[model samples]
Target: MTYPITRSYVAIAAPPLRSIPLHFSAACLTGALLTDIAYWRTAEMMWTNFSAWLLTFGLLLGALAAIAVLIDIFSGRLLLRGGLGWLYIIGNIAAFVVSLFNAFIHSRDAWASVVPTGLTLSIVAAVLIVINACLGWAIIRQRTGGLEE
Candidate 1:
């Protein structure tokens, strides 16, 4: 066996995953805000103007998500995991899928018909989901490293 003389090491940045709860919640809220703002601005263009229905559903979902996230955010614990986390994931995934459909199939037909209401708003949802996923994954991964609650 031979021994080496000099050793070189590369430094890798550790991600700021400790703040996943706050990051995820904040991103989700921001994403929703963006999508809603865009929707409100272009409400006149959509074929379906179910503003009341959309408002009710959005409030319900947003309240539940905000509550769940707030619990964890305030406590610095994974208060919402497993099913709750999955619920959030499912909602975001649904938004992403719907946006994909709107962006590609429904919205592409006409420049005016679908772009304003379909894919353009969907992109905001997609971004929110992406941010939430990254934050959630970081929190979960930190568990294996014996991070403090």
Candidate 2:
């Protein structure tokens, strides 16, 4: 008996647009992880110690997420990897909501309003969640009858 090997190429890619949301969510989670660590250690000075860096990190992360989302939508491939897609989708949605609350309520100040900032994050997160759900559905539909391979 003998076995044969096959070669294949996949040129079509899932759009990077949807990737934006995942990126932002990922960044936020990263920043939050850092902040949470600092908060636990420094208490009152956590914001003073790292707020600026975290804010910038979050902004950039959000921007990237938005770009990824757009790419995903344009290319029609939001559900990039099945299980991983769910991770990115749910994680991002939850991260976005928590980010809004943290930036707006937990980090509010007399002169430092976070409404615009948090709301902006929320929008990206929400958009990504919707896109992810759609993609998940489509991917599942594609795989329901047989193995994806």
Candidate 3:
């Protein structure tokens, strides 16, 4: 009699819940950039307010995401491959810092807020967020072998 060969595989997956805050933070940061553009085009105070609130929410959610990442690292659920993880972390921190400064600039009078500095900061932050998101997703995909659970 011939016996059939069997194989077992171990799956590497990240906690789905950990990514939720990151997604939201990205959305909020992108929204802030849009609102900043709107305010620049129309000089509307409401848009300025919207930008401020979006930045605030984005930063808060980013903090939550950072905490989750830290937990994963400490718990050995996440492994840094070729320092991509550190680059992602640094990019995120830079984005948050830029957004924080933009939030403060938004607190100024409406026109002065979105004219040049605020709008520039929003653009920079949005770009940084995008880059970091790409890096993060790449890391995740590499770890999961392109399968996310």
The list of candidate 1 runs beyond 4 A from truth reads: 1-59, 78-114, 146-149
Residues 1-149, candidate 1, lDDT per residue (tens digit)? 99889989965544333344434434543444454445546654342333223433443454455565566546655534556455555655565455444433332333343345644554555566566666566556655464432
- Report, for every candidate in turn, its global Cα lDDT versus the true structure: 0.48, 0.52, 0.86
Candidate 3 lDDT score relative to the true structure: 0.86
Residue 145 accuracy (lDDT) in model 3: 82
Q: Could you tell me which 10 consecutive residues in candidate 2 have the lowest summed lDDT? A: 110-119
Q: Write the per-residue lDDT of candidate 2 for residues 63-116, one digit (tens) a residue.
A: 567566556645765545557566655655565555545454435542233234
Model 1's alpha-carbon lDDT is 0.48
Using Cα atoms with residue i matched to residue i, what is each candidate's TM-score against the true structure?
0.36, 0.46, 0.86
lDDT of 3 by residue, 41-71 (tens): 8887899999989989998998898898788
Deviation in Å, model 1, residue 112 alpha carbon: 6.6
Could you say which candidate leads in TM-score? 3
